[model samples]
Target chain A: MLDAVRTARPRVQVITNPVAQGYTANMLLAIGARPSMTSSPEEIAAFIAVSGSLLVNLGILDRHRRDASLTAVEVAREMGVPWVLDPVKVDISPPRLDFARTLIGMEPDFVRANHDEFVGLGGADTGEEAVRHFAARNLTTVALSGPVDIVTDGTRIVRIANGHPLMDRVTAMGCAGTAVAAAFRAVEPDPLIAAAAALTVMGIAGEVAAAASSGPGSFAGAILDALYGLDAATILEKARLT
Target chain B: MLDAVRTARPRVQVITNPVAQGYTANMLLAIGARPSMTSSPEEIAAFIAVSGSLLVNLGILDRHRRDASLTAVEVAREMGVPWVLDPVKVDISPPRLDFARTLIGMEPDFVRANHDEFVGLGGADTGEEAVRHFAARNLTTVALSGPVDIVTDGTRIVRIANGHPLMDRVTAMGCAGTAVAAAFRAVEPDPLIAAAAALTVMGIAGEVAAAASSGPGSFAGAILDALYGLDAATILEKARLT
Candidate 1:
């Protein structure tokens, strides 16, 4: 999947929170995927029309972000471009949860969320059940990420267990992970494979980074280095999947 | 000044660009200052009322940022709180330049800018002259950051020659520097000393980080580690100030 993304060099239109923008862009660039963030609602459609995929992250919900995100997602759906929806912190804000539900109704190609967020979005108890339930209900792919990550597309389920605890300390690590999934979705047509590949890459990189880092500060840098340096053989050697 | 900041543990209200927010917050936290970013105009004044200082960064200006920045700066001034103004990329955008000029007129305690931004803001030729010119005109401290950073408070000028070229490769480094200055300003009333100490720390940290990093990605993490581990002895031994 990483090879496919590198080959495609897809340009992804990302409407993420301010906190996530810089790291997300850097991560995409490091992995050979182009990332653009044009928040102006007037120009979002035009930008999305030319991009390969879209990543809609509701991290800090503002009026401008809300309007632009809705417009971008609709445009992506109409254009047949795959998009990833990340319902960040949906459980914390009722308005944000409502916004996530509204976006879920629009039918994003992939829904990426944490275990808590998956439950908040009306999923079942276990990561496997939550992903399977959400994917079946939405008729799309659902990814539940945590210590053990599960991705399902109604029929097929993929489990990846490979990350580090240091990932939790950084502010925008999960948000960047969502963008990676969108990048993979741009290259791989199968939603289950795309979601699984993205999560595997994130996990392996996190594990590699945690080994080399002293704390959260250095862990962020090492993760980027691992992403940039990761090859197919290294991924195969380190990735723990089922 | 660094000692004062460590002792006070000042909470800074930062209304910065989306790209700079995470790093700025991390940098402040590494240096023992608390950072909060409240972009909502409705909540900014109340947030600033309790903050020890304010940092206004104009990197990516939208309607929300413009409105909230103006409101925050006004409240900071009214409440007699020290505020730092960072005119990021002011030369490229005429609208942003005009807005920065208006804010300058409101009299921020410190003005931080690059060489081009200093010139755009009507500073004279050299960094020294530019800082002195702006300081004299506005009756506020002016910090001109580049290869060599110069800080001035109308009469006194402090030159710090210590940063690394790696700093330029990373996005939002200058904006983060401006926040560091504000953090120092919160604990130390002397603008010149505060600006100089902040710049000195940033430079020494950059130099130290450059030694430990392989590229810009790793350099970012090393910078955070350097800042968190920096001590007065390290500063005294490494800093090159005039």
Candidate 2:
């Protein structure tokens, strides 16, 4: 799947996350996937139509991006583009949770989020059974990332435990991971496999980054370097997917 | 000046560059300066009032941010707060140029830009004379960044030539530099010396980062790490300000 993504070089459109915009784009580039961050409503539809998949991040929810997100989600559906919904920090904001619900009702292919975000968006928990049940109910893949990662789509499930604690120290690490998943989703048909594979690659790369890092600042950059230097041999040896 | 910034730990308010917001904030943190990225018009005045300095970046100009910028500038001026204006890529768009002109008319403390952006904002060249001329006409300092960074306030001019070429490969490097300048301006009373000192620190940090970097990806993160680890001993030895 990593090879497929690199060869395809599929363009992934991500909306919101003004804070993490550059880092997310750099992370996508590290994994050999092109990132398009067009969140403007005037030109987002065009960018979305041309992209293979879309990622709507609800972290920095604002009035202008609200309009852009609604338009983007509809355009992606109209164009048959696969999309992921990342309900970031929805637990803290009622309005953000409501907006996440709106994106959820639009039938995203996957909902990539952490445990708190997953549960906040009405999921039971980060437990495997709960994740699988949520995926079955939502009719979308549930990528619940934590100390261990679980990617499931009702019938199929994959567990990947290969990252480092340093990842949590970095801002937008999960957002960046979700973006890589969106890139994989662009080229892969199976939502479960796409999320699983992308998480595996990012997790392994993160482990490599943590080995050489002194702190979050160094870890953040080293992870991008590790992803760029990541090869098939390393991926095959380090991958913890089941 | 660096110690002053670290001791004061002044807050800098950046009004634009959603793309570079996180990196810029991280860079500010690396140097012990607090970064406040508040672009919403409703509350920007409140943020600006408490902030030590403000930076208005015209990189990703949008209708909503335009309102926020106008409001931020007015509030910053009303509060007698220092501010820097970054005319990013104004040559590419007439409307953006017009907007830059409007900000220019409002008396920014400094106009920090690249050679093209400097010329685009009506400067003749990046030469010492042109920068000085621009500074005198606008009643502000001109900080022209390039292979050699030039900072002048119509009279006191400093040229810093201590950065690595790898700095350009990293996205938002210039915008990040402008943000750092804002942090320094908060502590230093002189705009020319503030811009000069900040660029000298960042340029030296870039040189340090380049020593350990394999590519732009690594360079981007390494620069932040380098900035975090930078010290007075290294700054005294490596800075080429004249």
Candidate 3:
């Protein structure tokens, strides 16, 4: 799937939170994917329809993103393109949380979220069973990310433990991960494998980035270099997936 | 101004485009200044009124940002606080260009723009003379940035040439520079000195960051570290101001 992503160089429409537009676009580019980052209502529906996949990251929810997300998802659904949702900070705002639940109900192909976000999304906090239950109920693939990332689609479950704490220090790291997932999902048919493949690559990239970085500032740049430099062997060897 | 910023750690309200939200905040934090990035009209007037300075960066023009900028500027002016404007990509859209001219007429304390943006704002492209004329006519400080950065305020014109090419490769680099300028303007009484000091520090930091970075990605992180580590002597020794 990862190799396919590189070879195909699929275009992914990312309606990312304004904060992560640049990082998400650069992250996609580093992983050999083309990123179209236009959240404008006038352009989103058409842009998302033609994209290989769509990623909606609700990092900082506003009217613009809320309206754009609805339109983009409708078009993606009509066009049958895979999409990923990263519902960020859903625990804080009721309006934002409501919007996130609305997106999840639409059944994006994959969801990349952290513990708090998953919990806020009505997922149980009992680890594997909770992830599987949430995926089963939603009929969607889920990547429960943190120090160790848990990816599942109800039936099949996998855990990838490979990233560094420095990864968390960088801004919009999770949003960038969703962009990577959207890129991988463009080529991979199975949602389960696509989410895992993307997270695995990101985990390995994070570890590689941390090794060469002295602080969060340096990690921001090194991660892109690490993502660009990754080969099958490095991922295969370093990805602690089970 | 730089020393005062570090000592006081003034809060700056940045109505920046989504692309530079994280970078601008990080850049401010690195320089020992607090950054408040909220483009919500529900809160912008209050935020800007209390902030040490306000920086409005029109990197990606949208309704939310437009509304917030207008409100923030009004509040800042009423409070007698200094404000800077970064009219990004003003030449591309007529509507956007019209809005930029509107903002320029309000007389922001400082204007940080590229050569193209300055020209689009009706400034002649003949370098120093044009920059001075624009600043004098508008009764504002102007930082005309390019391979060489020209900071002028009608009467005084200074050129700073110390930045690296890699700085342009990073996303929102110019917006981050605007954030830096805002932080300096918060502490300095003179707008010309504030803009010049900020650009000189940014240019020197870019060179410092480029030395430690291998690519644009690493340069992003390295630049923050470089900004955080900058000292008066290092800036004085490395700055190329003529």
Question: Which residue window of length 10 is worst by lDDT in model 2 chain A?
Answer: A38-47
True contacts kept of each: 0.23, 0.24, 0.31
Error of 3 at A94 (Å): 14
What DockQ does each candidate score versus the true complex, computed on alpha carbons?
0.18, 0.18, 0.19
Candidate 1 interface RMSD value: 3.7
Pairs of residues at least 3 apart in sequence or in different chains that clash in candidate 3: A217-B221, A221-B217, A221-B218
The Cα local distance difference test for each model comes to 0.85, 0.86, 0.85
Q: Lowest-lDDT window of 10 residues in candidate 1 chain B?
A: B38-47
**Model 2 lDDT tens row, B125-193:** 777898899899889988888888888889888889999976765557888999889999999888878
Give the Cα error of residue A100 in candidate 1, in Å: 3.5
Rank list by TM-score: 1, 2, 3
**Residue-level lDDT tens digits of model 3 in B1-242:** 67788899999999877667888899999999999998787888777777999998876577767888888888889889888999986754456678888998888998988977888888888478888898899998899899888988899998999898767667678889989989998998888889998999999999999898766687788899999998989998998999
Query: Please, what are the lDDT tens digits per residue for candidate 2 over residues A1-242?
Result: 77787688788888857777888888887777767675656557656766889999988888888888899899999999999988999999999999988888899999988888888988876789998898898788888898888988888888888899999998888899999989998988888888888899899988999898899988888898888778899998998876
**Estimated TM-score per prediction?**
0.67, 0.67, 0.66
Worst ten in a row by lDDT for model 3 chain A = A41-50
Poorest stretch of ten by lDDT in candidate 2 chain B: B88-97
